[model samples]
Target: MDVVIKDRGNIKWTAIMLPEHVAAVKQEIINLEKVNQPLLDEDRLSEIEMLIYEAMEYNLQLEFKLFKKGYIESIIGSTHFIDYIKKEFRIKDKNELTHKIPFQKIVDVQKV
Candidate 1:
């Protein structure tokens, strides 16, 4: 036997929200109003591509400042691949895990 109570009080709804529902709501908020990722222009994308390609060809370390989730984050790694068509920067982190990161909101680039 199971019993489910509803329509009890306004504040009680928070207790009923499942983890998946909460995550969805948070993602919606980020997509609609919270995040501040600026769109990178074509020129800037090309410049960044050059930097990534140079790093890839020379086995050099590169660092990038990316805008995401209402703030900027920096990642330092060697590029595994730059998917220009998909606009994803596939990089190998220190743990040797390759991550496909969104590169459309790059704020700064530096080679280390």
Candidate 2:
């Protein structure tokens, strides 16, 4: 006589998870998807700075890609305030909500 056995991995364990444990597992999955920040060359950094300067001087709308906490975030807005000493700038979005970002966090810049 022979017996057959089957293996159920993580799915079988999920049945015993409480609601809070399930939520925590979902959040862990999301955190696992986060990516490392991209490195920018000097030429690329110069280009981004030039674009930002033009946007601020000409009152043009610009889109900025930022690296924050291992995630890439996009912001569309016009440059509102720049603090040179602090090396950070503020942008006002379409909804007039201002967001302050640091120079080192900038990944890319484009005209809108």
Candidate 3:
């Protein structure tokens, strides 16, 4: 999907995502939540929360790195993955450009 983030001048920046990447992030969050749920102590809960956030942050960073390295699409499926990309990449107006296109198609268009 394509998400559009606009600057002050209404200049839009688009973020592209694959369904698989989104799903993988969602699964990661679910797994973290599952791991965190068993802890009852406040300190442990806090630590788990922090860990979850860190994991998500790290995942987003890694995804961006992969994107830069030309791994444009993900092998998993989740919309939340795009949300992470939006936040990590400082994207805006995600609803504006959620279209699905082939990765190669986007790359080809970008070349123009």
Candidate 4:
């Protein structure tokens, strides 16, 4: 008999699970993710979008709190141009390099 030790930290044994079991595990993981996700509803998304639009229109510098790969990041810049098709903003930072900030990544915005 082969003795196999499974480590709780890794899921290597999941490879031997029944197809149905593997699907159930995947679904459970997805459901668990929803419980901890940040609440950003349509209204809030629209509000953030509007704020960016206003800043771009006035060529005003602004600050943002946004999520990047599950970490919060701070950015301050003026909206140099908007790429509507790409749904991102090209910002002119203090250093003068253009930065692309995805619309969906923005969590909070304020005028600088």
Off by over 4 Å in 3: 1-39, 60-112
Could you tell me every candidate's TM-score relative to the true structure?
Answer: 0.58, 0.77, 0.21, 0.59
Best by lDDT: 2
The 0-to-1 C-alpha lDDT of every candidate, in the order given, reads: 0.79, 0.91, 0.33, 0.79
- Tens-place lDDT per residue, model 4, 1-112, is 9999767753775878888998898888766654222668998888877887898888888887777655568889988888889998888889998889887777777888
Per-residue error (Å), model 2, residue 30: 1.6
> How many Å off is the CA of 90 in candidate 4?
0.9
Cα lDDT of model 3 by residue, 1-112, tens digit: 9998656431221134466866776777666644111214666446534543564565422121112232343222112223333332221122433333222222111100
Q: Candidate 2 residues 11-91, lDDT tens each? A: 898899998998999899999989888999999988988888889999999999999898999999999999999999899
TM-score, candidate 4, is 0.59
Q: What's model 1's overall lDDT?
A: 0.79
lDDT of model 1 at position 94 = 83
Off by over 4 Å in 4: 1-37
Residue 47 lDDT in candidate 1: 89
Steric overlap count per candidate: 0, 0, 6, 0
Pairs of residues at least 3 apart in sequence or in different chains that clash in candidate 4? none
Which one is best on TM-score?
2
Residue pairs whose backbone atoms clash in candidate 2: none
Query: Which of candidates 1 and 3 is the stronger one according to lDDT?
Result: 1
Estimate, for each residue in 1-112, the C-alpha lDDT of model 1 and write its tens digit.
8998666663566578987987887778666754567777788778887888899999888887888767778888899887879988888878887877876667777888
* TM-score, cand. 1: 0.58
